[model samples]
Target: MFRLAALFLALSPATAFACGQPVCLVDPDSLSLTKIITFEGERAGAGPGHNIDDVLPLQGATFGEHFAGQSVGARGPHDEVSGDAFAPLTMMAGRAGQNLSLVHFSGNTVLNGYGSAGFPKRDAQGEGAIAVLFDQDQSALAFDLRGGEDGAALVHFYRRDGSFIGPVPVQPTGEFAVAFLRSDGHADIAGFVLTNTDPQGLALDSLRFGKPPDMS
Candidate 1:
C-alpha cells in the first residue's frame, strides 16, 4: 500500500509540494536580478501548481510574506489536474491526460499568491495590490503574466526606503506574456508591487533580475 501511494504521488502532478526552511539568499543590497521565466512545473500536470509555504522564493517559490507578516500563509501545495481555460496560456496543457498543462514553467519556481493565500488570478475586484519583500536589493525585476483581456495589471517597484517608484503597465493579453521593469531612477530594489486595475490582476510567475542596465 505504501508503494502504491508513492507511485500515485509520483505519477501525478497534483501532489502537494514539500515545504522546507531555506532562508532568503538574495541580499537586496547585493546581487541584482536579470531575468525570470514561466512556471510549467516541467509540464507536470494539466496546469500550473504552486507549493504554499515554499521557503525558496528566489527560484520561483513565493509565499504571502508581505501580508502574512513572517513568511507564512500559503494556499498549501496545489497539484490538482485542473484545466487551463485561459486562452493566452492554453499551451500549459497537462502532459498526462494529453490536456494542456503548465507542467514546465520557465523554472520550477512560482508565486503561490506571493503575498496571500488568495489566488488573484480570478479576482474580480477593481483594484488590488500584492507585495513581496526581498532579502536583497532588486535593481530590476521581470516576470511572465497572463490576465483577462479587459483588465489591466501593473508591476510596481519600490526602493529600500519603502518608497514607491514607477509602475509598468502589463497589457491584457489573455495569455501568458512577459513584462519587464526597471527602477525609474536606477534605484536599488526592495520590494515588488503588483496592482490590478479594472476587472482583476493577472497571474504572475517566474522572475529574473540583476542590474537595471542589464536587461536579460
Candidate 2:
C-alpha cells in the first residue's frame, strides 16, 4: 500500500508542486481561490512580471518504480530564460546502483539546474532553474530557487510526513515568500500562499487555497 502527500506553495504570481512519482495533480489557477487551507496575498513586483512562484507535493506519484518523485520546477534553455516545469508526483524506480539525478524541463527553451551565484540576464547563457530535491532515503526534502542578488537566495526544508519546517533564508535577502502543503491521502492538490511586500524585499500575507476540495 502506497501513501500520497500533496502540497502546494503559491502566490498570485507564482505556483508549485511535489510528489512521489507516476501520478500527479495540477492547480494552475491559485490567485482567486477561497478555502480554509487557502488565503490571499500579493507583492509589488517579485514574480515573473505576472506569475507567482509556488511549490507542490504529488502523492502516490511515481517517477518509474524504485524511487518516488521528490521535487519539480521549471528548467531553462539558458540561465536567463525560464524553462518548462516538471516534478516527481509518484514513485519511480532507479537504476540498480544509480539514484535519480538531473531533473529536467523544456519547451521553447531548455534548462537543467538553478542557482544565485550570478545573474542569468548578465551571466550564463542558459538561466538557472528552481527545484525541490528529495534525499536519498526519501525521509526529507529541500527547496532551491536562484536568480536573486547577493547570496540571499531562497530555499526551504520539510519532513517526509508533510510537516512544515519553515523557510530557508539567504544572505542579503531579496524578495521571498512561503507556502504550505495540503494533503488528504489522495492524488490531487491546491496551492496556498504567504507573500512578502517589502520594497526590494519579501512580504508575507495570509494563507490561501482553492475551492471544491481537489485532493482525494
**lDDT of prediction 2:** 0.25
Q: Pick the candidate with the highest lDDT.
A: 1
Once fitted onto the true fold, the runs of candidate 1 whose alpha carbons sit more than 4 angstroms away are 1-56, 59-130, 176-185, 197-201, 212-216
Each model's C-alpha lDDT? 0.37, 0.25
Q: After superposition, how far is residue 163 of candidate 1 from its true place, in Å?
A: 2.2
The ten-residue window of minimal lDDT in model 1 covers 16-25
TM-score of each: 0.45, 0.22
Q: State the weakest 10-residue window (summed lDDT) of model 2.
A: 190-199
Model 2 TM-score is 0.22
lDDT over C-alpha atoms for residue 170 of model 2: 43
Quote the lDDT for 109 in model 2: 13
Count of clashes, each model? 45, 61
